[model samples]
Target: MTYKAVFFDIDGTLVNEEKEIPQDTIEAIAQLKESGIDVFIATGRAPYYFQHYAKPLGIDSFVSFNGSYVVYKGKVVHEHPIPEKTLELLESTALANNHPIVMQGAEAGYANYPTTRSIRSLPNRSMICVLRCPATEAATGRRRRCTKRCCIAKLTRNRCTRRPKLRSVT
Candidate 1:
């Protein structure tokens, strides 16, 4: 039997702590493509966080945010957005606990508490935008507006890379 496609996790698999892909890995991926295996990225990171890697790795398709969002050949094929009620509950919970929340979407990383140590420690954190919860989205609309999301809130349950599945807002 032969595999037609290969999926790779971004962090510590394709890239190291410094977020750099080794030359050997690049060459190996090139060789895989030469042999006709389609390479794709399957990462917990949001699409915007890892979009830059696509060009170098020759990957056009990916499963991001830990399978919560999927883009096949530059088109979003799957998604699991958090319901509006759930998000509101989270916001209130985080507020009560005084925990910061950092959200991830296809466009950018959104943060509720910008000065948290979690957001400040990152080198590329300048990209994160400080915003309130679900305010920017239209006041009344049937369509949800969000692709992916990550929350750095200090919580004790249901953690996936310390992020909540944020797919859409009211």
Candidate 2:
């Protein structure tokens, strides 16, 4: 009858339209945690983008990349990456259509496009790296492929804020 944990989505649930967490929300989370209720973030955002908000809010559990990955108390609890074949197809499709692709890994984010201001605006500014290779290279290990447990493909344009069609690789 009672919930033991609460999961919050980052974009609109935890943070407001301006991407800022309200004081009341912070206090509410604190109160819940103080009451021994586990608070977690369930979002499509990559893990690299969690610390800024998670740390401040004292949330240590996460279901990131739209459930493709999960972490509890700094340890990986679950992860699922897109199949290699699917990744290849997606890469080729994006290239053919000229749709920018942003790959989210357990540790960092990768993009086939050149470094733009929008990519730099990600929560953890330093974690999202611009891939040096062309779109044809895709995720070749020779060029620092995302070696994380889970990788999600995000289809978008130059501006990341634009409605990116999120696709889970797994």
Candidate 3:
């Protein structure tokens, strides 16, 4: 297929379970840029999370917060915020379940509570915030992963390069 632009998913497709982006992948992106192809990352992560990332890859644009937000050349091209009514409903649901709720928007990621209660109660249990589950499990009847680690490993393996770049220093 002939294409003028290429889009990549970030979490599993680019960065692995350890959240490491591969040097080869970065080099590959650089090469693509050198060839005059447009490269972009599509992710559930907020645009700010990509601040330290996109520059090195020569990414021309981004679709963040699961496409609810878009950025080009450090400027917002589009933004879709969750309505307050929806937020209220979700919060109420979560409160009933004694669980935590997280909201991921174009600008940032936020949790109702940063503690483990919120972390443990999430159905899909993604690090990135996306309103995919009901506030309470009873309300949604969602089936969560029986095993988190193995599932995470499988998920990361499927999305990222086998050998990704690793750095020790923060």
lDDT (C-alpha, whole model) for all candidates: 0.65, 0.65, 0.54
Model 2, total clashes: 1
Give per-residue CA lDDT, model 1, range 1-170, as digits (tens): 89898998987889988889989889989988899987889987777677778776778889887788998877888988776567768666765787766566664565656665755664455334323213223344343333334233222232213344465331
Which candidate model has the greater TM-score, 2 or 3? 2
Worst 10 residues of 3 by lDDT: 161-170
Ten contiguous residues minimizing lDDT sum, candidate 1: 151-160
Q: Write the per-residue lDDT of candidate 2 for residues 1-170, one digit (tens) a residue.
A: 78899999888789999889999999999999988899999988777776788888878899988887888877878877776677767766765686777766665555556366855677655433333322224544354433222223322343122212233532
> In candidate 1, which residue ranges exceed 4 Å CA deviation?
96-98, 116-170
Superposed on all Cα atoms, model 1 deviates from the true structure by an RMSD in Å of: 9.6
Which prediction has more favorable lDDT, 1 or 2?
Answer: 2
Report the alpha-carbon TM-score of model 2 versus the true structure.
0.66
Q: lDDT of candidate 2?
A: 0.65
Candidate numbers sorted by lDDT from highest down: 2, 1, 3
Q: How well does candidate 3 match the true structure, expressed as C-alpha RMSD?
A: 14.7
Local lDDT at 54 for model 2? 87
Residues 1-170 of candidate 3 have per-residue lDDT tens digits of 66677788877676777777888888888877778777888877665566556766767598876777777766778877665455556655775696766555433334534556654544334343222322223344784421211211112322311111111100
Residue 120 miss distance in model 1 (angstroms): 4.9
